[model samples]
Target: MQTYNAPLRDMRFVLHELHGLDALTSLPYFADLNAETVDLVLEEASRIATEVLLPLNASGDAEGCIVENGVVRTPKGFREAYDVFRDGGWNALAGDPDYGGQGLPESVNKLVEEMICAANLSFGLYPGLTHGAVMALSAYGSSELKDLYLPKMIDGIWSGAMCLTESQCGTDLGLLRTRAVPQEDGSYLLTGSKIFISAGEHDLTENIIHLVLARLPDAPPGIKGISLFLAPKFLPKPDGSVGPRNGILCTGLEHKMGLKASATCQISFDDAQAWLVGAPHKGMQSMFVMMNEERLGVGIQGLGVASAAYQSAVSYAKDRLQGRSLSGTKRPDLAADPIIVHPDVRRMLMTMRTTAEGCRAVGIWVAQAVDLSKHANTEGERKEAADFVALMTPVVKALFTDLGFEAASLGVQVYGGHGYIREHGVEQYVRDARIAMLYEGTNGIQALDLVGRKMPAHMGRYLRRLFHPISNFIEAHRKHEAVAGMVEQLERAFGALQLATGQIAQAGLKDPEEAGAAATDYLRLLGLVAMGYMFVRSAVIASERLAGNTDEPEFYRAKLASARFFIDRTLPQATALFLAIKSGKASMMALEEAAF
Candidate 1:
C-alpha cells in the first residue's frame, strides 16, 4: 500500500532552519506571520492532505471523471473532498487580502501546495488553476471586473481555468484560430474550440471562470494580435449571483495517461459572452502572469509525486524481504535480508531522497523571492527579488519536474516487479509524474526560455540574480574547513555553469540553433549548480547545528548526508552537461530532415 506523511519535519527544516521565516516576516506584507502560526497552518494542511485526500487518490484514478449529457462529474468522493478543502479556507491561503484572502506568503503557501499535490495531484488541479487565474486577474483585470469576480473565486465558490491551447496550437500560440468579436455592450463573443483544458468543466464547483486568448477580427496576424478575455460557464448578475449559462460548453474530456480524476476537457465556445482582460492585443503579457505561476505549481506537482513515491519506496525497501546483503545476513531473524541492506537498493533510495530534499530547498528559496518581488520595501530590493524569481522560475519548473519523474521511476525500481502493477501504487506515481514534464509549457520549452530569453534579457540582468550569489558563495567559502569540500564541488559545477552560459551567449549570437541545441543541457547544468548551492548552504547550517548540542541531531545529520550525496553523486552531471553544451548544434542539426 502507498502512504504519505507530509514530511513536516523536513518542511520545518526548510522553512524555519534552512530558509528562515524571518526573511519573509520582515516584509511589511508578511509582518504578522510568525513561526508558530506558520506551523499551525502547515499542521492543519497536513491533516487534510493525509485524511481527506490520500484515501481518494487511487480510487479517483480508478474511477476517473465522466462526461454525461454535457455535464461533467468528478470521481467518487472528490466533490466532498473538494468541499473539505474549500470550506477550510485552503483556497484562500495565498490570495489577495482585498479579495477575501488570508494574505499568506508564497513561501508558506507553496509548502502547503506540495502536500496537497503529494496526497492527490489530480484533485490539486481544481484550485491550482483557480489560483493562477486569480493572479492574472489581480495583476491585469480592470477594477470593475475584480470587484465582481475576485471575491467568489478567492472564496472557492467558483473555480477558474486557463483556455490557451486550441486543437491547432499548443506551444505556438500564433497558430491559434480562436476568434473574438466585439459587441456593443463592451463584451466580446468568443467562438473556437480548446483541448487539454484541466479542470475545464467539473462538478466540484458551481461555476468555472476561463481566461482565454483570442484574436480580434482586425487584429494583426500571429501571436502579437492575441488578446485575453474572461468568460465564465455561468454569467453573474449585479447581485453577484449566478445568472445565465454562457455560450461555453464542454465538448469532450481527454483520455489521459494519468491525472484521470482531473477533468481535461475539449471545450467549445459558440459566441461566448466575455469581457476583455488587460489591453487589446496584449494577451500574452497578461496571460504570462498566470502561466508563470502555473509553471511553478506544476513543478510542485512533480515534487509532490516524487516525495510520495520516495516515501512508499522507502517503506517497501524496509519491509520486503529480498536477497541477503552481500556484506552479511543482517536480518538473519528473517529468511532474507530487507532490500535496504543491499548497496544497489541503498543507491536508488538515496537518489530519490536527495532529489526530493534538494528540490524542496530550491523551491522554498524561489518562493521567498516571489514574496519579496511583490512586497519588498524598496524598488531596488523588489527589482532584485523579481529578477531572482524570473531567472529561477524555469530552473525550478524544469529541474523539479525532471528530477521528480526520475525519482518516481526509481520508486518503481525499488518496488521491483510489484511496482509495475498498480497494486503497490508506485506505478501511478510514474504515470502521474510523466505529465508534469509535458504540460505547463513542457520541460523543453522551459529550457529554451531559460537559455534563449532569460539568459539574454536586459543584458543578463536576470542571470546576475542567480550568478552573483553563487559566485559570492564560492568566493566566501572556498577555504572554510567545515564545508570546504562541499564548497569545492559547488564551485566546480558553478564554474561549468558560468562557462556554459558564456558559450551559449557568444555562440548563439552567430547561430540561434546553437543556443537551442544547448538549451536543455544548459538548463540542467544551471539547475544542478543551483541545487548544489542550496545543498552547500544547507551543509553549512547542518555543520553548525551538529557542532553544538541539538535537540534533533539526526535531522541535521540526515540533512548533511543528503547534501553530501547530492554534491558527490548528482552535481557531477553538470560537467557532462557542459561538455555536451560545448559540442554545439553541428551534430544536433546536421542530420537531414528526411533521414528518418
Candidate 2:
C-alpha cells in the first residue's frame, strides 16, 4: 500500500521557496506559521495518514457501507479513526479558535487536506463535506446559528453534507424542484428531494447539518428564486442539546462506481425546519463564497486521487519485474528486470511525479493566496492575491480532476493486468477519480467559467494576473542558465494563450460555440502553463536549497528533472490546443441538431 502523506519538503519549497510564505508568516494571522511549525503539522498529518486512514482504504472499498434499521454503517475502523482525527485537532486545523479550533493558516490546512485525502479519499469525504458546511455556516449564518453549530462542527463532533443536486438538476439551479416556503420567524419550510448528497447520512457524527438549496414559493423565476437553508438531521436546540430529528430523511443511497465507501444519498426534506443562510435572494452569493474552497476542494480531490494513484503506481513499477533493462539486464539472475529500467516506464513515473509536484506547488500557492487575500495589510496586495486565486480556482478544479482521472487511468496502464484487478487498488482509484470531474461544477462548466465569467472579471486582469508573476519569474531568473529554457517555454505557451484569447474573442462574438467547444481544451492548456510555471519555480527553489549542502540534494535534483520532463512532454499539448482554437468553431458546428 502507498502512503498519502503530504511531501513536506516539496510543500515547503512551494511555499517559502516559491510562493513567499514568509510574507504571510510575518502577518498577525499567520505569525506562528514558520517552516518549522508547518513541518511539524505535516509530520503529524503524515502520521495520521500512515496510521489511521490508509488501512481502511481497501477494506472500505470491499466492505463498502450497508444501510439497515435507518442507519448507515461505515466500514470497520472508520469511527475509531475519525475519533483520532478529531482528538488530534486535525479537523480544525484552519478553523477559527473561538470554537475550540486550532486556528492555523489555511495554507497548512490545505497540505493536511492533501495528505488526508490521499490516504483514503473515500473516508476523507465525510469530514471534507463537514468542513464545507462549517465554512458556509460560519461565513453566512447568523450568530444564533453559529453558536448552535460551529463548536460541534469545528470540534469534529458533528459532520455535514451539501444538498444541491436533484434528479432533474445538477448545476442548473433554475431547473431544481426543491422548494422552501418562508416561515413567519424568517426560517423556511424546506420540502424536496436532493440526490448525489455525499456524506448525507452516516454514523461518523452525532448530527448531520445539511446546507440545502431550494426555490421559494413566491420567489422570482429561475435562479433568482433559489435560496440556501440549514436543515440538520436533528435541529440544535437553544441549550445546545440536540432537538428532535428534523423532517429530513435519507431516502436511499446512490450505488456509485467510485467513492463507494462515501455514501451518496438521496435525501428527502418534508417541510423541514430550515434556517436561512444569508438573505434569500442573495443565497447564490453566499454559495459562491464557499465555492472557491469547494471548487479548490474538488481540485484537492484531484490532487488526492492523483497522488495516491501516482504514489501507488510508482511503488508497483519498482517492485514488479516484467522486462529486461534497456541498458541490457544487469539483473540477469532474474528472468526479467524491473519495469523502471525502461525509459518509457521512467517517463510514465516521471509524468505522475511531475504532475503531483506541480499540483502540490500550485495548490499551496493558491492556499497561500487565500490566506494573504484575507490578511494582507495593504489593499493592493490583498486584491492581487485575491485576484490570483479567483482566476486560478476554476482551472485548478477542472484541470486537476481531469488530469487526476487521466493519471489514474495511466497508473492502471502502468500496472498492466494487475492494475485492472480489484485487488491491486489502482482500478478503484480510477473509479473514484471519475466523479471528481463531474462534481464541483463539472469540468465543462469550470472551463466555461474560466473563459467566460472569470476570464473577463477584471477586463483582462486575470490574464495579467497570471502574466505579472510569469514576467517576474522570467526577469528574476533570466540569468540562471539551468532554467532559462524552461522560462522560454513558458513564454511560448503564454504567446499561445494570447493567440487563443484573440481567436476566441473574435469567434465567440460571431459564434459562442467557438469558445464553448474549445473551452475544455483551452482550460487544460492554461492549467498546463500555470502548473508548469509553478513546477519550474519550485525546481529553481529546490536547486537553490540544494546549493546549501543539504542532506537531501537528490530530492531537489529529482524535482528539477521532473520540471524538465513536464516541459519536454506536456507543454507541447498547449500548442496543438492553440491551433485547434484558431481553427475556429466550424468543426464544432459541422452539422446542425439533426445531423447525427
Candidate 3:
C-alpha cells in the first residue's frame, strides 16, 4: 500500500494566505480561533489521517465487507480505526456545540475531510454519512428527535446513513415507491427499500441512524407526497438507549468496482418505526440538507483520491527508470533517465499538480463562503455569502470530480502498465473516482442544476455574486505588470464564460433541450474560468510574496509557474466549451429513439 501524507504546506497556504484565516477571527463565532490554533488542529488531523487511517486502506479494500447471518461485518481494522476516530472527538470537529460538538467553521472541517478522504475514503464514509445525518436532524428534525439522536451521532457512538436511492429510482425521487403509514403512537411505520446506501450497515458503530424518504398513504402523487423520516436500526427506548431491533434490515451489500470496503447496502424497512422529520410532503427539502452537504463532501472525495493518485504518479516518475530526455541523457551514469526528465511526463505532472492545487483553492474558497453564509454578522453579508454558495456549489461538485477523474487517469498514464495493475493502487483511484461523478446527483445533474436553476435563481443574483468579484478583480489588477499576463488570460476566459452563459440561457428560453444539451459544456466553461479566477488570485499573491522577499522563494515561484500553466494551457479550454455550447441542440436531438 502507498503511504499517504497530507499536503500540510499547501493546505496552510490556502487557509492562511489565500483565504485569510486570520480575518475569520473577526466573526463572533470564530473569535477564539487564531492562525496557530488552526495550524495545531490541522497538524493533529494530518497525524491521525496518515497514521491511523491510511494503513487500513489497502487491507480493507482487499478484504472488503461481508455478511454473516444477516449481520454486515467490515474488514478487519476498520472497527478499531473507527473506535479511535470516535474517541478522538474527530466526529464532532464541526458539529453543533450545543450537542457535544467543537463548533468549528465548515472550512476547517472541509480541509480536514480532504485529509481523511485522501488517507482512507472507505473509512471516511462512515463519519461522512454521520455528519450528513447530523446536519439533517439538526436543521429539520423536531426537538425531541434532536435530543434523542444528535448526542449519540455527534459523539460518533452511532453512525448515520441517508436512505434516498431505490432500485427503480436513482435521481428521480418522484417515482419512488417507499410508503409510510401513520401510527396511533405518533410514530410512522415505514415500508421501503433503499439501494446504494453508503455506511448503511456496519460494525464500526453501536447503532445506525437512517434518514429515510417515504410517502404517506393519503398523500398526493409525485414528489409532493414524499416525506423524510428518522429511523434507526434499533428503536431507541424511553430513556434514549438502544432497544429491540426495528423492522430495518440489510438485505445485501453490493459488489462494487472500488471503495469496496465501504458498505453499499440494499436496505429494507418493513413496517419500521420512524418519526417524521421536517414538514410532511417536504422530504426533498429536508433531504437537501444532507444532499448538499454530501455533494460537497463527494467532490472532496474526488480531490482526495486524485491527490493520492498524483502523489503516487509523482513518486513513480521520479524513481522509475525509463526513456532518456529528448534533448540528451539526463543521467549519464544510468542506462536511462527517470521519466520525470521527459517533457511529456513533466506536462502530465504539472497538469495533475495544477489541477489539484487549483481545485483546492476554489474548494476552500467555497467553504469559506459556506462559513460566511451561516455565521456572518449581518443579513446582507449572509445573503451575499449564500448567493455565492448557491451559484458555485454545483460548479464545485461537477468540476472538481470531473477533473479528479482526469487526474487519476493521468496517474495511470504516467505509470504505464504498473498503474493498471492492482499492486500499484492508481487503478483503484480511477475506479473509486468513477463513482464520484455518478453519485451525489451526478455530474450531469450538477451541470443541469448550474445552468437551469442556479443561473436564473432570484433573477441571476447568484451568478452576479460570483461574476462581480472576478470582474472587479480583473478591472482592479489588469494594469499591474506583475500579474498582467494572468489577468489578461483570466479576463478572456471570464468573457467566454459570460458569453456562454448568455447564449445558453437564450437558447434554453427558446428550447429547453438546448439547455440540457449545452449544460455540461457550459458547466465546464464555468469551471475553467472559475479555476482561472483562482489562479489569477494565486498569481497575484505569489507576486506579492516574491516582491516581499519571502523566505520560501521556491514555493512562491512554483505557485506562479502552476498559475501560468493553468492560464496558458487550461483556461483556453473555456473557449472550446463556449463554442460547443453555441452549437445548440439540433445535432444532439437529431438522433432517434431507435438509433441506440
Model 2 local distance difference test score: 0.83
lDDT tens digits by residue: candidate 2, 1-596: 54355577777777677777687888987776677887888888988988889988988888887777557888889899999999888878888888878877777788788888788889888888888788888889999889888999988888878888889987888888888887889788898898888888998888998888888787788888888888889987778878899998887878888887888888899989998899877777777766667888889878888888888888888888987887788588888898878888887877777778888888887888888888888899899989989889998899888888888888898899989998888898898889999887989999999888777676788778887877788778877767888888877887788788878777877877888987987888888888878877877776777778778888888878888889888988889999887887777788889978
TM-score of 3: 0.99
Q: Which stretches of candidate 1 lie over 4 Å from their true place?
A: none
Task: Point to the candidate with the largest lDDT.
Answer: 1
- For candidate 3, the lDDT comes to 0.90
- Model 3 lDDT per residue over 207-290, tens place: 899999999998789888899999999988899888999999999999999888899999999999999999999999999989
Instruction: Put down candidate 1 lDDT per residue, 340-434, tens digits, no spaces.
Output: 99988989999999888888999999999999999989999999999998998988888899999999999999999999999789899988999
All candidates: TM-score: 0.99, 0.97, 0.99
Cα-based lDDT at residue 498, candidate 3: 91
> lDDT of each structure?
0.93, 0.83, 0.90
How many residue pairs clash per model? 0, 0, 0
